[model samples]
Target: MSNSNPHRFSLESFRRKLASVDALPQLCVLGVIAGVITGCLMTLFRMLLKLGAMFFMPDNDPEAFEQLTPMLRSALPLLAVTLIGGWLALHSGGSRHQIGIAHVIERLTYQQGRFPIRNWISQWWIGLVSVLGGLSAGREGPAIHLGAAASSGLGTALKLPHNSLRVLVACGTAAGISASFNTPLAGVIFAMEVVMMEYTTVGFIPVILASFMGSVISQSVFGFDPPFQKAGVEMDSFIHLPWIAASALLIGLLAGGFVRLARSASRLDILPFALRLGLVGVAVGLTAFWYPEVQGMGYDSMRLTLEGNVAVDVLMAIAIGKLILTAGAVACRVPVSIIGPILVAGGAAGALCGMVGNMLLPGVHTDPALYALIGMAAMMAAVLQAPMAALMALLELTHNPQLMLPSMLAVVVACLTARQLCGCDGFFISVTRYGMHPLQQPLMQALSRISVPAVMERNLTRTRRRLSYEQASALLDANPEWIIIERSSDDKPALAMNAAHLARWLLEHTADDVLIDAEGMFDLLEIPGERLELAPIHLQATLSEAYQCLNENPVDALYVVHGRRPDKPRISGIITRSAIERYYRYEDQSTTKNR
Candidate 1:
């Protein structure tokens, strides 16, 4: 128990300070391995994306790869046809193939840190194809998956212990983010702060190892700096706070709208996933007529926003256009994600707002570049509700102060608005969609339910007096599974008298008072199992879950704590063995009648 205290402390500290490193030194090598795998995977993903681009090129394009000949380009429909092959091959295995972060988390709680290795590759390939086929997706889904998978896979392949595997998975997730974005610190934060949810020494070693390794791998190929560079950000005037706040509010509202729209649009009750995604393709084709910039990754839109290339009229239109398209694409739920599209829309909107500010107040206006940065940040914060991720992204990618202030302000507002209106943080919404709750610290919740503090009984016989003949006789009369002779802090011998042994003793020994006084004298001798130990309840659990905790307990009786603290444990009472039998009987009867 004392040895485990350090692990808990590390996790707690890691959660508080995202920038800190406090994990174990022993796990450092694995973290580096996680980073290398993540970098390799990211590079592979980029190459696959290039391949996808080549496949979709028009016949007339001079830039078309030799691999995709003009004839194949002419028969463009073939590209869409074969893409399904990857998805099918990947998803057709077992139910385990459907595993996501949620499943990983579920395994963490009950299954001693086991994760499925064989199934990860299949889903990984499927995600890659989804993006390759113009599904309006981002790298996040696959990046984290690959990151976790690679680390978890490594642990599994090496035949490490269960706890070690969990640590490896954390390393993988961190490395994944590092490789994907070249944001090493953010990668560490993502793994420790988000995935592992451990802030203590446990996370420190893994997160640092993963982050550093991932950064090294990514830098080896893409260089140590950011891939896409722009001018440094500059601070804006405090007078523009109102404008920034207004923009933030508007982006938040739109973000909420986008979330709802996406969910609703994705609902193809009768159609399959492919069919639904194809429907999104149709929308893209139609929307392309008006705004072809929305066709691909919207790189053009981001560039144009920074350059202030679009007129006020067109900027607003592009914003709305991307918003609708993103919502629709997300609804279809193929390879769709809110990442690239939200940035595009938000940047465009911010640029438009900047233009307006420039027109209205000449000297006090915000910069186009600044607005562009803020827009990107705001939309990302709103849509994804990952303020730290967005802030770090802008900081690492742009390193501009002029943009930073508005970006931070807008991001905070947008994230808050999205949370208030949308009923979930961005990642949580996705987690919830897949039938899992996105808890900040699940150990906190798990500790609340069926914990040793909650289940263990404190009512051991405290009196050290040797049991009198009358008292021993009385204790035997009451049916106890195991009777303790006395309350003891440490190892002390107590009379271990079971009901059967007591009855046998009574039959042989002619104690005349035993038979008469022992009846209905349960409290005369202290029943050790009567006292209850209490722990905090995290609340919102169903009665059925409570029942489960009660049933699995070692003791025949337990308490359903109304609240967490023992002294103030609200309205609940002790649950006796007889009460449990009756409740089960009632439940069974109810089920039978309902059936």
Candidate 2:
């Protein structure tokens, strides 16, 4: 019986339509859905963070960890850490603990963008505990993890094609950043530069739409205020270029040092979860007692730096303190993000440079606000290796075109210094080196553009395991491209013979010799070239999957199948490796012919 529900039917049709080569329309719709979902979830995450802060903070200020008594300030993080550590120790969930940006990248690379629900659940509480307990954690990481997982989970629930799921994950990533920072363009660039690591016009359109919707949803809930608000400032003279270069160098050095520290901490994986977490808690507690600015996302302190309200010595301490504490906390596997703290540290470094400039060279005019803003941009560029996205974010937050030229110089210098002199790629790459697979090459990118249903030969004949000579001849005469011999057991293919080969064999051999018996005909067909061993792949498999199947196995062709369960397998069609090669290599041929 057909399912009578309209929603289910519509979803089913959508899933089916998503298997085509031109799935961009469907993917853009999915992006809208992902954006809405991520935006709502991020708002909720922020609201919950405020609610947690209300419990202990004065006037419900989320950044008021400094106002708590010394004993409470130290004890609260310890208590939060103990609970989080104890819960993880008991539940562990067998690899579900891997929940963050790095985990998202790993799953996209190795698992085809399938994020488990268990990790999503873990991110919710883990992020909450880290921030509520006054640990130097950022909300962006959890927001991204939750958003990406939710969108991927939607695809998984609908049994969508792998390509669609991968796109949905990228959509979610864009939405997450957009919702978190209200910088839609930066979010889109960030998804391409960091998450997808490759971009095409078709891929970018959906991400752009997702980012727009995410920003809209976030603005509706929280007023349309940029995360950072500062008075207008500009680079007054060309004389400031040398100072900007020096500031970028210092910021790059700090970013590289942070990456090194985080990597070192990640190496202590042999330590027990509770012990490592406890040590992180203790470190945060000790640091918080001395430098409360390091607690939470440190946005309040960053705002002070922009206003030039913070003392130079205090700003220097906050910069170094956050760099060390955040790196250590992340290394200990704290379920938090580093992006926010990295920006705060960068701003502090820039503010320090601005103060020293005013002291050393009193004649030259200097804007500490400009330095702080440029520092934030440079640090983000250096740490994430996303210079364009960082620059876009700076423009969006400050909305000052005059800041662009100096910001560009600072961002470029910082990136080169971090990568060339300090010898580090970025924070995420440094700590998650194992998950850092190269982006798909151009040919593989072309192969992944379309799915199996679009390329697989649908003109196929299904027959019994053994076929009579007359039946085989008649089947060949029908001009079916493939003949699938039904298997008695689903674990192995019975036979997948090329009809053209069968026709040639019939022409070469006498009917009397070939048609001695059904068993004899099958035995003769077992000779090389008569048939190929079949690797069963899903009907929704992309050309990339077909190529991978052929490349990884000895099989020459893959049988497109319908059911996922081994017990209920049904042949849908067949695709040969040669067909896949021809599909992509045809472009190469066309270019050659044009030349």
Candidate 3:
């Protein structure tokens, strides 16, 4: 309503501010919002899972699928998969099936942080069904999917810039991991390493804040108990460190094998959704029939492995059987996560090694729980290609500052083995390897850093396609950069003329007192102007989008607008290839030279 109020609250101003590198304070606010939203969602999801567990199990323990009768245990996966597959089969279009961590990565890399509501809605039910049905699944994948979607949607509603939205997505990702595991430090590292794929001191502060908030919310509800418990874990000796590192190497190989199998199974995307799910479900059911330890999140089994309560033979069965089944379930697009199951498999492998070591060398002090802790770190680091995050998780979960040396050694060995010997990228990337690359090149990366709103020319005046003498005279007085030609009813502008040229033309035909008909006498229509073949891009768009619009169409310039809706977009500014090129060429030269 007022001049200063409108100017201060304008979307263009907000977007331009977001484009700067010093957007930490605003991002911290968004981080709080993301943390609260994701924390609440995760709490509800966990409660629902508990409620579902009450229907069949003795207690409300969702992980206790083993307590069910053999017939019910075998039938649950098949029945649940049928219903889930049928539901997914019906709505399987666009981004419906794309609902998990891999999908989250794909959207961030390609869609510029815009996640669809359809996929977000589907994630809630699909994730709930997976764990409740007795399939070897993890809740973390669904939690991340739900959290990232909620954060992205919040940014979208506020008309935030894409760069800001991307940061919000990272915040949601951190919140998801932190709330799920109560490991705030690990959550921050995981978001930076796995999702955002880049890190800076300015960018990480908000992420750290969001992770801490998520942990606080979860701690209020779930209390201080983590998924795994350990008491006073210490290394046996420096001599046994070699055996532990060797075990990490084996876990890395196993991780590589698991990823490869999942990738191979993902090729069955051609098959009908029901058939693929039915086949995987049958496999899970048959496995659950014999070894129910393969069902649910397997955190219970992981706890037992740490306590040395699980027998060696049963541990071997769970370690191998859960690996193959979980890999297949994920590859076939079960919409479940492998984070929890991977930890279980690693713990089981470590427990078996500890048994063998104690039997062979009777004089040595062998603590299998310590080995299990190290194994959990190694498996997570190798499988996700996130060594720092896994190590942080190990420290936070154990609450022991002294295990850093062994954890780091195991994580490094595992990561090296997976990358060098096994020839594997992280599982998320390996499965979704369909010709997508990050903005890695220096110039492109630099271009992507700032938003279009920050760089676009805002010193322009809008007018009708044809201007009268008096109308043109008044516009020239302002000395605007360009005059935009448009009609009130049209979606985009018609053309833009250089204000200098119009000013020059007006000076030459200055016979105002002679009563001249400028339309016929001067023929002002022949004035030089650039034809407008402009495409509509959002204020949140980066220079990468500007380049993309130019490449995809026969257009030289773009109109920067506030929103994506077709009917009511508030036109803000304009951008051109020359302007974009000059901005980068002048500003980035020194940075590029140093690099």
Top lDDT: which candidate number? Answer: 2
Query: Which of the numbered candidates is closest to the native, going by highest TM-score?
Result: 2
Candidate 3 displacement at residue 330 in angstroms = 2.0
Clashing pairs in 3: none
For residue 190, model 1's alpha carbon misses the true position, in angstroms, by: 3.0
lDDT per residue for candidate 2 within 526-588, as digits (tens), equals: 634667778888876667778888899887788888875664567778899888888888756
lDDT tens digits, residue span 1-595, model 3: 6556657757556656887656777788888989999888888888999998888876888988778888999999998787678767677752137888888888887787789897888888888888898888888888788888899999889778777878888889999989888888988998888887777665698888888888899889988886675767778479888888888888889888988888775478788767778888899898888789989888888888888788777788777888888898877877778888888888887777777777777888788888887888898899988898888888887787777898889999999999889888877774332433473345555566667877788888867655567777888777888777665556544466678888887777764632346462333346665555567787778787787787897777888876445655566888888888987886577556767
Question: Candidate 2: lDDT of 105?
Answer: 79
| Candidates' C-alpha lDDT | 0.56, 0.81, 0.80
**Superposing all C-alpha atoms, what RMSD in Å does each candidate have to the true structure?**
12.3, 3.7, 3.7
lDDT of candidate 1 over 376-406, digit per residue (tens): 8788767766677677777766655456666
Clashing pairs in 2: none
Q: Rank the candidates by lDDT, best first.
A: 2, 3, 1
Rank by TM-score, descending? 2, 3, 1
Worst 10 residues of 1 by lDDT: 14-23
